[model samples]
Target chain A: EAGVTQFPSHSVIEKGQTVTLRCDPISGHDNLYWYRRVMGKEIKFLLHFVKESKQDESGMPNNRFLAERTGGTYSTLKVQPAELEDSGVYFCASSPGGDSPLHFGNGTRLTVT
Target chain B: SQQGEEDPQALSIQEGENATMNCSYKTSINNLQWYRQNSGRGLVHLILIRSNEREKHSGRLRVTLDTSKKSSSLLITASRAADTASYFCATRDPGAGSYQLTFGKGTKLSVIP
Candidate 1:
């Protein structure tokens, strides 16, 4: 089976611009998660989706960031008025749920200049 | 905030040798998982050990969890150059009320051939 796939492996945008990252989870997986790793920092959770419903979005950093999992098959993360500090690698993962391991995608590396 | 802390931050081992990395988490967890990421690649799940499991092994990879100490260790036997990558420990905390895994600042392992 194909693993989780992310779009635009690398993205570069200017500060104050908007950027969106996409993730397609593995088939039959009900749980999708978003995480990011800033330079010199640990990977932190952003949000989670369970079949089109937002399960946990407490990890979202600010209002400027938005995530949606429409149809529960794929997810998109958008950052409006992006700041230089928002540059990082955004990773998407999916699982069958209930203590199962997650399958991750090759993250989208966003560079805000 | 990062819940799991990986020791050594980095590691270097010669081929045919063994590599061991440790992770300590702050909260009670249901299970702990280890992942590997090669340069410019997505994270690949390596192993998972439940709170009730003391030791689990798959091929050359071995994981041990000590829930009492809130710590876990990953051991890679007969390391090869291909094993060179960043190894991360992620914990699934039950209290977090979500399936999102809390990751640590990974240990960068360099396997010298």
Candidate 2:
């Protein structure tokens, strides 16, 4: 089976711009998650989706960040008015279910200057 | 709040030797997991030890979890140059769902061949 896939392996945008990162999870996987690693910081969870419904989004940093999983197939993370601090790698991961381990994509490295 | 903290931010070892990384968390967890990532690459799941279990093994990897102490350790035996990567420890709390995981800064392991 194909692993999780992410688009635009790298993205560069000026501060205050909007950027959207995409993720395609493995086929038949019911769980999708978003994470990010800022410079010199640990990877942090953003949110999770289960079959088009957000199961948890408490990790989302603020309202400027929006995550959606439509049709229960793929997911997208959009950051509006991005700040310099948002420059980092945005990772997408998928798992079969709650008990299964996750598989991550190469991630979209966003650079907000 | 990142709950997991990994000790020895980085480690250097020789090929054919053993590498051990430790992790400690503050809150109760349902499961603890370890992941590895090559430079600029996605993370790969290594092992998962549930709170109810003390030890688990996969291939050359061994993981131990101590619920009372809220800590875990990952051991990679007969390490190879291929083992050079960042190893992160993640914790999933009860009812936090799989996406609510909090990850540590990770231990950068360099295996000199």
Winning candidate number (TM-score): 1
TM-score (all chains, Cα) for each model = 0.97, 0.96
The candidates' DockQ values read 0.89, 0.76
lDDT of each: 0.93, 0.92
Score candidate 1 by lDDT: 0.93
Q: Chain B vs. true chain B: TM-score for each candidate? A: 0.96, 0.94
lDDT of 2 by residue, B42-93 (tens): 9999888899999999999999999998889999999999999999999987
Alpha carbon lDDT of residue A82, candidate 1?
99
Clashes of each: 0, 0
RMSD to true structure for each model, in Å: 1.2, 1.3
Q: Candidate 2: lDDT of B32?
A: 94
State how far residue A55 of model 2 sits from its true place (Å).
Answer: 1.1
Model 2 misses residue A28 by how many Å?
A: 0.7
Per-residue alpha-carbon lDDT of candidate 1 for residues B2-104, written as tens digits (9 for 90 to 100) = 5788987999989999999999999999889999999999899999898899999999999999988889999999999999999999999888868889999
lDDT of 2 by residue, A15-38 (tens): 999999999999999999999999
